[model samples]
Target: MKPIYKRIVLKLSGEALAGEKGLGIDTNTIMRIAKEVKTIQKMGVEIAIVVGGGNFWRGVSAKEMDRTTSDHMGMLGTVMNALALQDALEKLDVITRVQSAIDMKQIAEPYIRRRAIRHLEKKRIVIFAAGTGNPYFSTDTTAALRAAEIEAQVILVGKKGVDGIYDSDPKLNRLAKKFETLNYIDILNLGLKIMDSTATSLCMDNKIPLVVFGIDEPNNIIDVINGKKIGTHVKED
Candidate 1:
């Protein structure tokens, strides 16, 4: 089936890449994700990915370290994840590029809006790493920012465990309600933890639609791009 959006930004957390171990990259898990990505790429979709580095480091969790230093470390972790993902995709014969916000010219191209767009237009998968080239901003915000820059039609978020947005923590409350659809204001007013408020506000202001779905299912990404309703949908309306 044809994809609903010609261009999309895929947001992946580092924990998602770690699989059940939740510590470091899992070779098998990354391979599985890479294969899924290949399936979608073959459908002529322009894909840009924003990956988090929680598996390697989390700036917010560093109580004794300087916030800037910790966040910078987190940024480097994202770069590592990006390289691994690039390798996996290349092994599958998929053309891919890693663009780093904090440039290390030897390994990745510096974050260039036009160049990134060009890569997508050429049917290349672009992985964005380093969390917006600044400290404190989460990768979710990076996804929103890049999607706007690239004029992507949607932001598809593949969550590690939970399937969709909930009224409360589903893990803590089994009876928590799942929202099939939500307006941007609802997310803000209700204080849902789907994405940080900065990220949510950015998407809201730019009128970008977001799909939050569980990445555990093999076809979740494909299904989401195909317009299947398997998760919470957030938009202006």
Candidate 2:
């Protein structure tokens, strides 16, 4: 089936691949993600990914240490996750490329917008890493920045906790209201957990669609790519 968006940026939470271990990458989890990505790749969707490194380290968790130093270390952690995901994707026979925001030429290409778009055009999945190559920025911002630069039709978010956008944290609040559709302003107004405010604002300004789905579901990525009704849709109304 043809995907709803021809070109899409996939935002994955690092914790999703932890598989209850919460330490490092889980091979079975990675394979599941890769297989899902492979299924979509075969549908001819140009894919780009921005993965968070929360499974390894969180920037806020490093605040007790030197702030800048800790943040840089966090960026490196993201690169680690990126490479891990890239390896998984390739093992699934999917052509993949890793681009780092920071200059890590020996391991991966520095993120050059045109080069990344070119990779997408060639049907190679591009994995973006290093969290904007700067401290004080979240991977959510990186996803927004890259999505805007590459002009992706939408950002398909694979969130670890809580499936869709909710009035409250579904994991904590059993009575929370889940939304099937929300406008960008609605997210801001209702405080939806789609993306960070910065990310939400950026996508809102650019009119980029954001879909939040549960990554715990095995075939959810493929379902999203095939335009299955699997998550909350955040768009400009």
Candidate with the greatest lDDT versus the true structure: 1
CA RMSD of all predictions:
0.6, 1.2
Point out where model 2 deviates above 4 Å.
Answer: none
TM-score of 1: 0.99
RMSD of 1: 0.6
TM-score of each prediction: 0.99, 0.96
TM-score of 2: 0.96
Can you write out model 2's per-residue Cα lDDT over 188-220, one digit (the tens) per residue?
887765677888899889999989999988889
Worst 10 residues of 2 by lDDT: 187-196
Q: Evaluate residue 104 in candidate 1 and report its C-alpha lDDT on the 0 to 100 scale.
A: 99
